[model samples]
Target: MSAAAHPREREIAADLRLRAARPPVARLSRKVLLVGTATACVAIAGAVAYAMAARPGAASRPELYAVGGPPPERLAALPADYAAAPKLGPPLPGDLGKPILAAGAPAPTMGAAPSASPEQQRLVQEGEAARTSRLFANEAELRADPSPSNVGGEPVVGQGARAVLDGPVDRRTVSPDRLSAPASPYLLQAGSVIPAALVSGIRSDLPGQVLGQVTQDVFDSVTGRFLLIPQGSKLIGLYDSQIANGQRRVLLAWTRLILPNGKSLVLEKLPAGDAAGYAGLEDQVDRHWGALFGAATLSTILGVGAELGAGYRDSAILRALRLGTSDTFNQVGQQAVGRALSIPPTLTIRPGMPVRVLVAKDLVLEPYSG
Candidate 1:
């Protein structure tokens, strides 16, 4: 209806009309593509949900049945009469409460049956008769009987027979009498030193006597020669002071010194001094106590490690703690006691060590030897 259109404009108008008039196939394809995508997304979501449900996890599934089934009755729950039906009745005619032994059974012996043969039995009986007869016989009658002849045809006195025949069994022969010797200057002179060493370690709480030995030869000052108290003589010392738990000091004085000649000289008085290496010994004991404390600590640590390695349970840990604590406490107590009563430094002489002793008075020589 407008003015006559140009040839170029008519071509352009025809192109626009053709574009507008064409079917909306692209839009339809886009919708179709969107629907396919949505379907695929739904399928993926469903697969994921199924996988989650099938996988084993902490989540609990619903039980098929809600209530539990009835419990089965136990045999113990039956009536007393029913339970007692299987028990056996007494077999004896009278209810004596004793088990009935099978018929034809031999009576049970109190102990093993005698297995001795007739010859052995005869010998045993004869020996028993002889022993009874001898027991009733007087000592004089037993002694009057002649000695039994030996295999060599020589009459030999049996020890038993000789004991009865011998005269009143000399009391001295049975138990030797102790020598009664007075203190003599010839035995041990005063102001004489005897070198000796402890036979064993003596504790402050030790009871009774301590033993020692002479380390070297003891010489007489006036004689200028080795005295009868030679080297290797045994020295028995009686602690002068009482050995109490809290008392650590010790004063050892020789009571008796046995000479090499099998004779012993009893000492009456002995002087106390720091002659032996007792000081050094006391120091060593102190060090030992310290080491013991350290050992206790180390043991406690080891116990803890052992308990952990075994298993880290509440009970195990507690038990280990208790044991360790007890052990530590015991060790501490021992150390405390030891410290309270430290051994005197003057009495700390080791075995084989040289020691000097001063005899306070003259000693007596006794025939007895220890």
Candidate 2:
């Protein structure tokens, strides 16, 4: 029994040694080990590559933000801070409602921040996400200061102001509704007639007030208002009688008066109103003024100096080409009150514009009693 068992054990051990020493078994084990090592290395490398590539795009995105300038209404406009902004409307009573302050409230509690409303949060989020989004093109910081040549000029410190003039309905003219201004309005038609006959013929026998004096210039309150009485002042409108407490509120843009002494007067006043309104009116004036006064009757009849007698007036730089018998003014007059026998009428262009015009007074020439 012992001998048989021993022989079998010896044979089994020999067979095991033979299998371990075989070339194919050892070669196959080596190949298997190499493939397993390569697979482990690839898996490890791929995980690390993914983590590295994702860091900035993921974690740093929230911290990346662009700094921008303050909004337009805030540009150098008075009362920079909201608190300093001028209070419009009726003044608040001495006592306003109490603003109950929470003594120890957290600066930033969970869920939502106290300082920002939902709308504000949306704007902030939009601005923060703008670089990657299509809301506005990408922006980058450009320092205007800490430069060499910028110091000498009106250096824009940080980001300077910007104004855009593009929009629908160019905001550069007095639209029809603007002329009837709130305070005072003037009607304007470029060279309309002055009704001299109407003014002279319809004589009012009412008490007449003498304006100019023959004496030397001094302060006189004759018309119950201030009056400067010099020949030079009289030639011009140095004295204005409040002709009824200025209830007659029309601003004359320009006028021409051929005084008895043969002096021409050309006066122009500015259009006054809201900033937007003034800008619009100025734009319209620049666009249409030359075309306007070019063919009116007043341009013709007020007749150029060349057509008048020796002492004829009307000498102004604006009137450089104005002295032709048929000027832009006379045609306007003819168009206004047609030919021959006519009553007195007046034409005026006022400071305010409504794209149209309105007139409250008439002009008629009157002969002085000698």
Candidate 3:
């Protein structure tokens, strides 16, 4: 009669005691889970792309853009005819409807034949005739205006140049005359030359002074017996630093002359020349070709890189960044090229270059006692 002796209890205990050894069940790895998730995402993205591509719409129509939300489903109803609809404000004092209709009418074709009553045609013809008469009268008045007489009938200037040179040229008598007297016995007159050699080198990168030593003695023009300027005199001048493209000369002019005897003369912008009487000095010119070529090469590379960086599938942010970068590069390249072009050519004249001073006016000076 005890509970431990029950047959059902004994059977349950026997079932609990029974056990078996089985093989271990495998688990999914992190790599497999990640790969499965990635595959599902790709399939979903592909389905969405296909749906967008297959959407029904006219190609020529404007593309659909996202809005804040769908348009109100229950909008206020509009009247069947807008013209018959009631206006909110009081009526204007003028006949607004008539003016609107007239404005909307098609404009008359230019130069078309008149299509009107005979009276209107007559008025239009009279108006045109009056305008024609006025124009002709104006032309006649212009012709009748007083003008200078062409007595000698000299050659008429061509029509194209009439606007530029329409006035009568003044006539003056030019007489040949000789000098009443020479200004001074020691005068070094025009056409006299002073030979000199450059004492200081010339580099046309900036505006600066140039020095030269007189290589020979200069005598008076009248008698050629007195020495006006002594040898070894210093010539002070300035050379033009502005260089044009392909230019090979250095233009310089003497402004002062200093003699070895401690005397100086202010020469009036006396031009300097080479021994051959040509204006300006010939020397080496540095065009900065290396810098120019480098800028050009860099510009080409930047332009090419900008074009290569663009792609079809790029996002808006990437596209904007690319565009900004490209613009910056293009601007920088253009500026570099401009800077290279703006660099003036450097002209260099070595010392001892033979030069000449051509006297353009009389130089009255005491004969060099030395």
Candidate 4:
């Protein structure tokens, strides 16, 4: 300010002051902004973490026996043979429509007198027949080659070791009185006892305690399920639906068992028709129908329309019978069959396939020769 305070000196000092002011403003502003953003980011991150941690039972759901897909490491172990074990049952499906002939038809007026539509009239007459029609569900067994590779086809596993019995089939199970083993021994190991249910009704009909005692060595529990291996001469007899082949009237049926890899094994043949014949629906009940309307005013044939609701169209009358829901079916002749034959449903040899099934309680069979 004293000696060098000339014009040039003053200008230089002024410029120096201005430059210092600019640095502090920019630096300070940046520091404040950066700290604010960092604090906000931390707060947001903490909130997100807390929300995620506070949720309850995020994994809550039915623990399906999933396969081929990996579940959590901590998940409980499934039955070791769960995928390979065969299931002996299957369930059902549906859809619906309304009256084609009547619009305001009251729901309460199903069969009040008789002025019902042709279908309804038929339904009423059949209602009585429904009660009259006798339904018999039974099972029969036959031996088939379990080893497909023996026939020389490359042994490729198409399915898991578990057998599956799904889809509709016409068949019946055998009463215990008839599940006797042959006097001869071949494939059947000695002493396989038949199921007690099998003998319940048959016990009264067979010649002796001999029938139940005949085969005590053929049944083996596979993966916790009772399975019957054919004892050379032992036969499973049943009544079933019709199967058409090329010019041959097949009184029985043999559906393919799909493996995990999709390979198949032809399961044993059950009697002509039965719970056993329908590989998968033994767990199902049957509701039979019959009609009696043939005249100038009506002239309707008896019909058995199984499913009657929306989404239930595809449900089997068999499955519906098992379900026994009002909307599932309308029947007069409903038969409750007893447990007779202990036939193993077809094994699904296919690998990696997961099947969800509902198994109804086993049925109880009493005696009936006619």
Tell me the TM-score of each prediction against the true structure: 0.30, 0.13, 0.54, 0.14
lDDT of 3 by residue, 88-165 (tens): 754433556445444445656789665899999899889656544422235456556735466567756673386347
Model 1 C-alpha RMSD vs. true structure (Å) is 28.4
TM-score-best of 3 and 4: 3
Best by TM-score: 3
- Tens-place lDDT per residue, model 1, 211-263, is 77887765544444435566788888766434333333466666777777777
Give me the overall lDDT of model 2: 0.36
Q: Please report how far candidate 1 places residue 362 from its true position, in Å.
A: 2.5
Winner of 1 and 3 under lDDT? 3
174-281 in candidate 4: lDDT tens per residue? 645755543332222222222211211111112221111112223332222332332221222222332212211212222222222333333243222222323321
A best-first ranking of the candidates according to their TM-score comes to 3, 1, 4, 2
Q: Write the per-residue lDDT of candidate 2 for residues 18-53, one digit (tens) a residue.
A: 445656543468888999999999999999998778
lDDT rank order? 3, 1, 2, 4
Which prediction has more favorable lDDT, 3 or 4?
A: 3
In model 4, which regions exceed 4 Å deviation? 1-252, 271-291, 294-370
Give the C-alpha lDDT of model 3.
0.85
